[model samples]
Target: MEFHLVSLILAFKKDTVGIPLAEISYFWGQMGAGKTSIARLINYCLGGSIELSPALQNEFVSAKLTVRLKKGPLEIERGRDSNTVVVKWGEKEDAIQASIPARDANGELIPGTGIENLSDLLFWMSALVPPRVRKSKTKADSETKRLSMRNLLWYCYLDQDEIDSSFFYLDSRDPFSRLASLDVVRYVTGYHDEHILDLEAQLDSLRGERMAMLASIESLARVLRDVGVESEPEIHARVSRLRETADAIFREISQQRNASVSERTTVHALDGLTAQAQALNVRISGLDDAISEVLHARDRDTRHLHEIETLSIKFRRSQSARAVLAGVQFHSCPRCAQILPERPKDNCIVCGQAEIDDIPDSTEEALLQRDIKQRSEELKEIIRRHDAAIIQLRREREELDIKKRRVERERNEASARFDSAYLSSMLNKERERSALQQQADSLAAMARFPQILDSQRQKVGAIQAQEAKLRGKLKDAREAAEKDATNINTLGQLFLDCLVRSEVPGITSSDTVEIPTNSYLPEIHSPGIADNTVVSFATLSSGGKKTLFKCCFAVAMHRLATKVGAPLPGMLIIDSPMKNISERENREQFEGFYNMIYELKANELSATQFILIDKEYTAPVEELDLSLFSRHMKPNDPSKPLDPETAPLIPYYLGN
Candidate 1:
């Protein structure tokens, strides 16, 4: 399905700066849908001539595109009084304009470029184009060639009024100066000579300012701390004498306390006793459970055997006789569709005793009574034997349970004896451990005395603290000096300047860069125009600074596209390039700006596709005429039929 064949989502994708390609994709929808917004996004993606606010994010990543250009032979002056045509491989890269010879089928050059239609001309030029190279081809004049021209593929912007009325013109304050003047893909892409230099200069300025600010902060902090700290040696000597006297007194008191205390070994005996008790508990539980289970099983089996025995007596007393009922197997079943196979010789195969030839009725009661008597006798005998066996089994189970209980009782007595013996031995071991612990404690006390030499410790601590403080002060001073040059304020100002230049009128970023900061320059102003000016989205003009942002974005993208080969996958998003252009003249100027979006950088791609978002105007927006997307706008829909009301606007009748 065509992406735009259905619903028209008025919204476009958003980005901080540059016409976002994602935003423009929705541009081709019906009237009231954003079509021109898409164009602006394309322009931005290609890094066209728009100026992005410095405040807006400008990230540089690679892009790719298929080659498409106006096919034409370049006209270059040949021999004296003659001209020729030649094919040049590279697009306008470094140099926006170039002159080349126009050539025919033969090697002989032509007088002027013969092709007209740009799209078709591009194809022809592509065919004749040569490999890109830095050096220019030398003419065979025999005299060493003096003058030669070379062509370059461009990812930059150019500023020309007739070329494209840009977003820069909409601003009243003119936040961007060099930017407003910038009007080409070459200029925006940084391919222009001044771009890289400007970036470097700004970065340098920021670094310098940052350092200066840091130094100033450090100087103030250092000057504030006036404490005259004492030397480590003097403080350490006084503290050491006091600590030595305290330690001697503490040792004497601890020794006296130790001599008076005695150790207890009873806890060990208690632990051993507990373990022995737990072992016996497990044995007692298992034996008791096993005995109960055996008794229950024996009782249940015996009861069942008794009941069956009673039934056996009734079966033995009953009489028995052969019983049969007669029925014929029909070849075809009347009730169902099924057919039965032929039966054996008997008339009724189901009951052999009866015949279908003379259908037998019910069986004799006497016969059934006789058969019951015989069955009852057999049942009684079987029951008698089963009952006897069950009784024997129960007797055995009871005997086994009694034996198990006796064994468990004996085991418990043995466990109690073992517990007492283990307890005695555990007490002896505990006493030994206490004795060893006392010896180790005596040795440890002596070892700690040397380690606790108070004089040395006090001296070390004092010196370390003094050294730390001095080092801290020195570090602060050095850092302050470095920071003075590269302070946050300095960097902020530089970044702000860049942003201020990139700012589109009314498009104040939720993002802000604090600038006008400097130790020397205390009265640094805010980086941007007043907050009052940065109003609602509705207040901002579409094709103004916001739209210009896309052009600059395109220039950047073009550079990246050339680096790689083929069509670019990255999308360009433009909200509304013509958002601000409501009046006819302004709209047309923006449309021209739209054309300006597709310059050298755009030409490198397989196709510079764009999504255009357009707002339907009450009048026939003449400014929109300059844009290529104007062709895509559809006539009024079936629902919104054109009639006497909308007729004056359309050149021809489009509705009933």
Candidate 2:
């Protein structure tokens, strides 16, 4: 987005140093020339950390970097050891000042911009929407984090210390930073564009909602099971059976009411009610027995499930231990203190059996875990069923007790009445019929549960279908992102070209360089004498090679970003491109590297700004741009001292 460094001003206690930047700025001198400090100060002014040398800690008062952003010239200034930076933008007359803190939680406000921190302010100035990414890779619904200025600077600046030690923080020890670094690469390459971000957000939300729905269904099924029904069909069937039994009872009661009953008939009716009451008591006792039995079974299954969980944990620990000790070869038994016999190949060291006979520990562990999972699920199902049975049995017992109470009340009323026996029998039968009708009404209410469960199932099914459709769309969109493929391909080829031009040892034109999409890191595939071998940045042998390798890839990325109009800054600040290399021994390789850089600048990157700090200078030819600024600082050569106007970065202090 065209972030060009115009100037850097370092204010000291005694004097201020103003260094003007150009299309290509080279600063090279002795070890303590303070060249690196210039780059660090520029980074510090732009909201980055600085490792202050003694000179800076003592005499350096503040540092300021003026840059030409897309909007206009911007000034960012930071005082030594300060936690905040001051940014001034707009015209020289009515420029706005923003007191930006390192963190937003510190609560400094940026004027005329609706941004909380420096990162957002930069993005706002660029007139680009800040991109959001998931904070965690493992969680689909993790909070989204916005890409910051520091992320973009990873590509723009290659510091001296990390030039050889790190590759864009891709292998950072801190997990969050590592992920952010990967996201930056993805963003630059168009893999993490706004469209993909939106689709991913939608997918995460839908997946979370769908999980909740499935959990609700499981809970609802358990509730239905407690009422002696597993499905809609089962619920309907049971309801129908209960209603039919109640209807039969009603018919018997109706017949008794219409029958002409003599004294003998009254005695028979009384005996029949007594008999019904006794039968209810017996049935209630049976229900109690069933409930108790099911409770015991449920408790037993719960204990078994607990045991399985414990064993599963122990099994996993054992597998881990085995994996850790698999490479060890013992000379003597630890317990017996006896020299061990020579073991045959493919044989167990402990058991002295063929390894083939003893199942692979990983395979065994997998099978054990699977078996434990299966058994645990089975136990859970059994316990759930037992609980349901217990609930149903208790409910039946309660209903029978109510019926027995009513029967006894009817018999007592009949005995106390002085009315005719036939009238007493008819009145008792009518009360019995009313009780049966009430029982039938209760059954009708129970039928509604099945309908409720059916509605919930429909909702879950619909959500699942929607989830499938969204997943398919996401997959298709990811596969169809042609821009990402083109950018990656271009970056890889550029990296290879840089490597070949620099004459990096052990690599030839035939050796293919690839930036794998999965890791977003470079890989070198070389055809070996016997088999193909793959090498990465970490495996590059010499420190000089590693440094050049990283710098080359960064240059290639900058070129690609410029070509595609990506949102990377237009300036590159490299501290030490030859920190470990010896120009006297490798003149051809040394000159070739700078030659490639000069060729690109003269042609494709004429507008880009380059700031390089090294111990040796590689002067650009006069045929190249005349705006090249090169500074050589020597410590005044105390043996043959000359002018006091050498203009060392901090002239008063010479400490490294």
lDDT against the true structure, each candidate: 0.35, 0.78
Count the clashes in each prediction. Answer: 114, 0
User: What tens digits encode model 1's per-residue C-alpha lDDT throughout 1-656?
Assistant: 00111111111123112222221233333443223322322233222333322111122121111223333222211121122212233446632232333222332122354332221123244443221111111321111111100111121222222113433232224433222222222222222223233332333344344445445544433322211112334334434543554455455444534553343123434444356445545654654565466455546555655555555455434322113111333456545646655565753433334442432233654565466566656655655655544444444445344544544444454455554443444433444344445433443333333233344445445544554554455345434443443333433333333223344333233444331221111112234557554332123344354345434434334434443321222223344445555537555445444444433214433233434344532222344332232323444555575443222112132332
Candidate 1, residue 608: lDDT: 37
TM-score of 2: 0.66
lDDT of 2 by residue, 21-57 (tens): 9888988888876888888888888888888887778
List the lowest-lDDT window of 10 residues for candidate 2. Answer: 102-111
TM-score of 1: 0.22
